[model samples]
Target: MTLLKGWRYGAFVGFIAGFIGATLYPIVISPMINSDYYKQIQKETRAGVNQEEIQPGNMKVWSDPFDRKK
Candidate 1:
């Protein structure tokens, strides 16, 4: 009976921790991990600009954004 009580307590704590983490992930961890492309899209949309107009150019610092050369 005592062993069963310990197991119940452990399961309850685990469930609470998991719920809190899921609730906070988008609020806390999402921005830090979002890609630059997605971030740009969000920024443009919020500014009332057309998303398609915000196209990416060959703007990489160390490499091209294409496979073929001119």
Candidate 2:
């Protein structure tokens, strides 16, 4: 019974903390961050691009760490 009571108290505290965080995020933290910049960049980057030709800048050519060949 004691163990179950402790679990219930923990769960209730966690729920209250999560609720407070969710309610405060938009009002307190959203304006301080430039979230729109990321969205705009996403829109511009995906606007016009050829998928057939892979851009050299986007390619990650690196040897795998697990490879036995030196």
Candidate 3:
């Protein structure tokens, strides 16, 4: 009985640890690993935007198809 109880407790702790690691890896570790790629994408997106022309009401509404050309 004692041996069975110890095995059960160990299994429970192992499962909890695995779950926490899986949850945190995507939110924390993955970003650090891909930080350079993320920075590059951010730079490219910002470079294409015209900062001065962006305003609250100075926007155009598009239809469902969005068939308009620039």
User: Judged by lDDT, which candidate is best?
Assistant: 3
lDDT tens digits, residue span 1-70, model 3: 3453677889988999999999999999999998998999899888977654774586554356767777
What is the lDDT for 9 in model 3? 85
Q: Each candidate: RMSD to true structure?
A: 8.4, 11.5, 10.9
- lDDT, candidate 2, 1-70, per-residue tens: 3553677889988999999999998887885596796789878997876654555777655558898985
Q: Would you list the C-alpha lDDT of every candidate in the order shown?
A: 0.76, 0.78, 0.83
Best by TM-score: 3
Error of 2 at 12 (Å): 0.2
lDDT of 1 by residue, 1-70 (tens): 3553687889988999999999999987886787776879878778975545665684434455586886
Hey, what RMSD does candidate 3 come out at? 10.9
| Model 1 regions more than 4 Å off | 1-4, 35-38, 41-70
- Model 3 ranges off by over 4 Å: 1-4, 49-70
Cα displacement (Å) at residue 37, model 1: 5.1
Q: How many backbone clashes does candidate 3 have?
A: 0
Ranking by TM-score: 3, 1, 2
As a whole number from 0 to 100, the lDDT of residue 33 in candidate 1 is: 84
Which portions of model 2 miss their true places by more than 4 Å? Answer: 1-4, 35-70
